[model samples]
Target chain A: MENSLITADAVEISEFPHLAQKYSVRGVPKTVINEEYVIEGSGPESMLLSTILEAVEKTGSG
Target chain B: MSFIKDADRPAVKERLRDMRSDVTLSYFTQDVECDFCRETRELLEELSSIEEKIRIEVYDFKTDQEQVRSYRIDKIPATVVSNGGASGIRFYGIPAGYEFSSLLDAILMVSRNESGLSDETRKALQDIKVPVHLQVFTTPT
Candidate 1:
């Protein structure tokens, strides 16, 4: 599944206040992809996959 | 003082029984200023005790320079789940409440050595040549 290419971290904002501030994590389940694209809430698997692909495309092109 | 309640042990054990391979939980923590470090470590220990295939490796965030660098850990109370290989699954805080499911899911996925993604998603992922890091910020609430 090419698992090695994708890294996922579930961060608890309250524990790391600094990270929450840096990422502007004011809500729960805020997903930040590659420090670029930000997903504000949880969604279906398809949505996450698309976000990942979008981030990858942006990184690849830029 | 156990983070995992005794009543929940059997269910947790049953879930972990599906593991096909050994999964290592590499936890990094410092002695000071880390609020959930102790609880996180205890939770991992209790979880590992439930299944023989799951192992917990503790490292100091400030002292374990090599591990910190290799894992690319920049924060305290981080747990990296792997099956003796880089799986790129990590938790950056105490995986409590609903988020605990995510930790278990990662462990099971690593043990199975599969992402459980759909064929189409897997195909799409093939085009990803660069590393994609996903930071899902959540609260225990």
Candidate 2:
């Protein structure tokens, strides 16, 4: 819902190195919070919010 | 997607003229295999031409082992967003569809060194002193 109207080119991720193996970046849009919390595949609104909160909680800062 | 066009170039150039801050769009692509590499490179170059403070740098994904290691990237078709002098934020897929806001947000955030997040949100993010990496992945839905 946040991104609509605009083309896909603006938000595309096109640069990554192979060492991400350590990060285990398995899927696209995989958000690792402060290298501490790992939010898996993108989920629906409710699930996404929960994941964001979980990351924040785990970080114990933001 | 082709900001390199004749008509649109002037507009972007005009806007970027007065803009303050140095931004770099680091484009990492492979030579022969990837599908979107060409298009992404084109877009970065075009965008760079539009903005004075913005510059685009392209690197080989497999061959540039040094850059790959330094940038901490593990995928192609990604972008490492740099603001002022700091370079680290990355996107692993096309930043479009619903993620455009995030892209523009990154630009403005880098330009201003502020996220442009709401007051409450700003308060929330300001406490970040340690390395804070936030990744959000999604399809163009």
Candidate 3:
């Protein structure tokens, strides 16, 4: 995803408290897309892709 | 202070051998120190030793203001995996445990300078008009 227009970052919650709070992250392995769609746990790759696409559609960018 | 165990080194080295381009791991740290800064640096150093294409460049977060700004790094234990270009790939903490494998995969991908994405994905990404930030939060577990 890094090569696309999508910029991916692996953020460690323990180091960045502000980001965790901003995203309302209460648990581990949270995937946040554009700070809009929040996937609580690690699921199938298709689920992750759909979640991101869903957010993109809602944001009127897709 | 070996982060990579002896048993894992052979396979890791074997995988790293596929590297075709140079990949520099630009690691940022400060004198005051963050929780895992030292460990992060050590891990990067060990990784660099595994392959000729891999290299580590350490910079202080406070002293190396220019490098920090250049890499757009704002936090400690930050690593920018780049190969002559800004790949927009970042690790904001120590790439340990399962994350270590992710780091290796990132290095390989950046070295190849390919996204390894499907044709559909490439077409889909082409449709994007704005920058999408994807942040994956995870622990070592």
Candidate 4:
């Protein structure tokens, strides 16, 4: 939500079973960027930013 | 029954005291068959009571088609935290337990109208030309 180009959704896996299954969220704090890059656990801010950038790159190329 | 404990009201109020602008929590829910919708609405009500700058606008997900489309909400019990503008910060379920703190932080962040990201990170985000959707899944614990 910080950036204008980004939309962030915080989903409680227990409440949204279908989403949990679709995202294959077996752990807490699983972050899926652009439905492409998945961060299994909580990471540093830099790591999340990098993953988002990488997702953007992949989307652009594909 | 109140969703927020009485003992935590003071601390929650203190935390919300940093808000510089009015924040609106646009909550979407329906009348039936949705889990945690009532609880989420009640939670937002209790939260709004703690700070005058915080307000909630409730909408029925089944009937409020225009709002649902405008907000781009795809699910029930969704809360879009914004300061009279698009913030893109949303919670797809009840923001309880540890996630409650995140809701508060989002409110404060939007009220202040600052992302609080590092300069380097902000600079790095400028290169992006496409929309990036981030779905973070977590449990209440």
* DockQ scores of the candidates: 0.78, 0.18, 0.59, 0.81
Q: Write the per-residue lDDT of candidate 4 for residues B1-141, one digit (tens) a residue.
A: 998999999999999888999999999998784889999999999998889899999999999999999888999789999987789899999999999999999999999987888888878886688889999997878
TM-scores for every predicted model: 0.94, 0.62, 0.86, 0.96
Please state every model's RMSD to the true fold in angstroms: 1.5, 7.6, 2.5, 1.2
What docking grade applies to model 2? incorrect
Q: For model 3, how does the per-residue alpha-carbon lDDT over B8-126 read when each residue is reduced to its tens digit? A: 88899998877889999999998877899999998998888777788898899999999888767877799988898788888999999778888999999999977787677667676
Local distance difference test scores for all models? 0.87, 0.58, 0.83, 0.90
Candidate 3, CAPRI quality class derived from DockQ: medium
Judged by DockQ cut-offs, the docking class of candidate 1 is: medium
Q: Could you tell me the TM-score of chain A in candidate 4?
A: 0.88
Residue B18's C-alpha lDDT in candidate 2?
Answer: 42
Instruction: Rank candidates, DockQ, best first.
Output: 4, 1, 3, 2
Ranking of predictions according to TM-score: 4, 1, 3, 2
lDDT of 1 at B81: 93
Better of 1 and 4 by TM-score: 4
- Pairs that collide in candidate 4 are none
Query: Interface RMSD in Å per candidate, to 1 decimal?
Result: 1.5, 9.2, 2.1, 1.2
Over the full model, what C-alpha lDDT does candidate 3 score relative to the true structure? 0.83
Q: Which residues of candidate 4, in runs, are more than 4 Å off?
A: none
Per-residue lDDT over B9-41 for candidate 1, one digit per residue giving the tens place of the 0 to 100 score? 998888777899999999999878488889999
Candidate 3 per-residue lDDT, tens place, A1-62, comes to 44446777889887788889999889988989988888998886668767767877877744
Tens-digit per-residue lDDT, A1-62, candidate 1: 26567878888888888889999888888999999898888788899888898899898898
lDDT preference between candidates 3 and 4, better one: 4
Q: Which of the predicted structures, 2 or 3, would earn the higher TM-score when compared with the native? A: 3
